[model samples]
Target: MQFHHHGYVSSDPRVEPAAGVGVNRPDELPDEIDVLIVGTGPAGIVTAAQLSQFPNVTTRIVERRPGRLAIGQADGIQARSVETFQAFGFAERIIAEAYRITEMAFWKPDPNDSSKIVRAARTADDPTGISEFPHLIVNQARVLDYFAEFMANSPTRMRPDYGYVFRGLEIGDGEYPVTVTLEHTAGPNEGATRTVRAKYVVGADGAHSRVRDSIGCTPYGDKANHAWGVMDVLANTDFPDIRTKCAIQSGSGGSILLIPREGGYLFRMYVDLGVVPENDNGSIRKTSIDDIIKQANEILHPYTLDVKNVAWHSVYEVGHRVTDRFDDVPTDEIGSRTPRVFITGDACHTHSAKAGQGMNVSMQDGFNIGWKLGHVLEGRAPESLLATYSAERQVIAQNLIDFDREWSTMMAKRPEEFDSPSELEDFYVKTAEFPAGFMTQYQPSMIIGAANHQNLATGFPVGKRFKSAPAVRVCDANPVQLGHHHRADGRWRVYVFAPDANAAVNNAAIDASTLDDFASWLTTSPESPVVRHTPEGADVDSIIDVKVIYQHDHTRVDLGTVPAIFLPKVGPFALTDHEKVYATDPEVDIFAERGIDRRGAVVVVRPDQYVADVLPLSATAELSAFFAQNLLPQNASARV
Candidate 1:
């Protein structure tokens, strides 16, 4: 039997899905749930799945959708999102089932005559080489199904339920403040209502969010004004770029985006509504799939377009819109105390699907905030840490809009509308960073302090995620990548990068003095994030986990000599195994390639795996302060 990310075997007989949730009435729900996720799209599933990692916190996810879509909207996983899936231990699964996007071909009319269409440019899909995982195109429904399966096997025993409609949102007086009134829509007990209360509520319910409206939150950006048509078809076409990711602009008709989907001979094509001719009577008319194909034929000109099969298609308006903040402010009003309500994904922003970010962004929003909420509800982290969710994601949301506003305007126009070729091509070149989801940088918050980091690591700077690099382990002499270091577990990783100790005193992983300093902090730092949040009588592993990677030849060093932290121990009273320590000095040192040295640096990585801060091993006080700013001390009351 093969065990997956959270350790449930694929063939496990004990697996129970969301349908196994034992709630048949309002009283059946736990009086206080840790989280109440209001939507079942990419955002809700990712959020619920992430929250399931923390055994101390309970999560309840309810969706209004009657069932999963057989043919859903939004495909194409960005490189950063693929890194996220790698963290979840499912990227390889999706990558195997999805079509890899290698290069994008741009088509435009020749400048001389404006009548002939030609391939203007062919560029590598990921020119920056920032991530090992490339962008991929797969069915959106398949991705959600994987999430559902992962949740079923999770240890938390909570799964998302569909056909449950939220009728009202209110703050009730009790341990759980946020009350969600729900009713089953199409199930056997139709119209049966239940009140589920939670400590926190997240509204990922799309642009028309009922929770956002109830909270008095409003969108503060651009309104949608354009509509586009998309179709998934198996086509018989003479066009050279039929099987490739191509954007073609015709002289007479509007532009079309042809992206090959997973499986053989299937492609999703997006066409501007301007391609469909308007009725001479001047009344509003709906565009059909045949009309889209006709416009594709007109755009191709000499090349023919014939649909061999049609899977699914639709016409929807696209726009650039975003909200001021992601979280709702608290007031003296009845339900706004401990149970705070927040929104993410489409609820916070809406944009054109040109960047293929609709689903990825939604999932990422869930990934970013889920752990933070878990930490707070479990009393491990200060409530102040939650504010960073709004600060970080809102900026990303704005950047998304600014790019979409420009990209959509450019794509909707004809070739003749542009002054020159350079102008249009430059648009694609300049906007590469946003869609790939690599350039997003968060502001300084409680977690990442302004006065803490002085000598940040170059390349992998503080506040940015650690850049990916190829490495090899010292223990097994196996290769590894730096970006794949994290799992869904809610623990911050403190990486001790030390030089190759030619010899060890008492068989330690590094030099005696550095090892002593690290061991002292790891075992007994009062202000350590892991130590600080530990309950008075509760036995829990420290919130921090220590990992060591040396910059020396793997052949020369002793891998088994690492400290007790790297090894497996029976309970708290057994011999430690030396398995977690690794080496990057095997071939060409990965540290050297990434602008670090054998002298080494102590880098702090957040639970989300973003680089929090860096320091010399001797600066233990600075390290202690880093945790004090984010984590709450044991027996401490709410800071808010």
Candidate 2:
């Protein structure tokens, strides 16, 4: 949102002035590039968008499709994804257009009338309030559109190269190690082949990924022997909970997961097709739309659906599969060699969509690899950093598969199978966090630090996404969420929470000597990560952004007494950025809400907004060591 630094913009500020590779970008595929991303799904698009921020890095994404997807199979948008949209600068717009799920109604067979379904229980979408964002239901295509727009407006002006199919790829020894073969799926040179080389290649291609095959990685898991027909339709239904998200189970007609879509009239139904027989030979996929409708009506029993139009539909059997690894480097060669190729999204993990995690988890996969690739390619971090992508995300994908397996099995269960009528609803409420995308907690590794200092900021748990809380900006007196200030710019964040103080009693000034000393050490000390990692001639905060949040109210905080680290000067002109400093809102104490120690704490957040580490104000040395584990010193030569 910050503008006027480059120049006065009469047009929309969101549309960044093109620079670097963005200027007069070539239409044809380049012979060489820093990174090559395959597929334009959620994973691929997000990776491209993140790479677009690093204008100096040559990155491109290719899709086999002739153009953008018209309709996407996925629609559920978890809260974590909404938070990511905020970082990419489009959460509000997407949320406004999305169908927010406030409450989910569960239905079961009525005891008096076993043939009819009755509402069992209605629970809030995010009963635990894990995130500020809402659980949304939006078309996957629209989400891709928003990300595509962000890419176009980025400094790199990235755009997906449609009609280019990833035929295959190989990793060799050299600077551009990944040699990729692509086919022209459309256009005058339809049958022609193109060869390109890249330092790294990412496979966001779906289940049948050619890139995954080339890397010798296979999705390993079994099917649930259950089939479901899903469809987005415009229909009139006598079912009272049709417009509401409902999980329906009839006495004998099977079950239905009815989700209301955006635009009011459109809704989606995942009609259970009953269990497939052993060695069915995929025959259940041949179930017709009419058959699906009949099954849906059967589930509803007394109620019925009069379909007017079908937007999109598909038949998928429940399956849970994940690869042992997500990268080209085999398990035996892990630390000895660096990864040159990677797989993400459905390429590495495939599972039932009942929990609506395929797209959400895939997007996170893109983000995980995107930043690591950017850093390593830009010489900000060592090539070893790339290994963490697979290390971290592979575990998360397995967890998703397990969660989806349980949820899918429960959905397919008969009424008599459940010991209690409320069992399904109880499971739904109990495991709400997983579906909301807040259950991921990265274990300690090169990127994620140990949680020894977690007590300093108990709320911002190490390895989890930084839970945002409201705070008032000191300069403007406007209340803001601290975590919302983070963007997908690939820079680290250091939030310094100063000791408690009563600003009014202290005459508009709280003792900040401790904060000033820490800020001076961070900016001037050679051992400081900020001073050690930032490139010469770059802004002080170009690598690590430092911000302070005081317990005192905005009016009582003295702006002049603040440290210079929080007020960095940057852009074409050395203009001081005063928006970094913040104070606790009088209405809500962020420190208490987020469990920050009253004595003070320093929370280090990764570019993706996950809390990397928490430290006491005096543990500046420990802070330096944490970043040193990942980032290369500015004086070090580029890894190429």
The C-alpha lDDT values of all candidates are: 0.73, 0.90
Candidate 2's residue-wise lDDT over 171-268, tens digit each?
88888988999999999999899899999899999999999999999789999999999999999888898789999999995999999999888999
Clashes of each: 4, 0
Supply the global lDDT for candidate 2.
Answer: 0.90
lDDT of 1 by residue, 279-354 (tens): 3232213678888788778777678888989898887666678876687774333233333888988999898887
- Clashing pairs in model 1? 171-335, 474-583, 530-543, 567-577
Query: What root-mean-square deviation over C-alphas does model 2 reach?
Result: 3.0
Q: Can you tell me which runs of candidate 2 are displaced by over 4 Å?
A: 501-512, 635-640
Off by over 4 Å in 1: 1-32, 111-113, 275-285, 330-339, 451-456, 500-512, 527-530, 534-542, 568-577, 585-588, 634-640
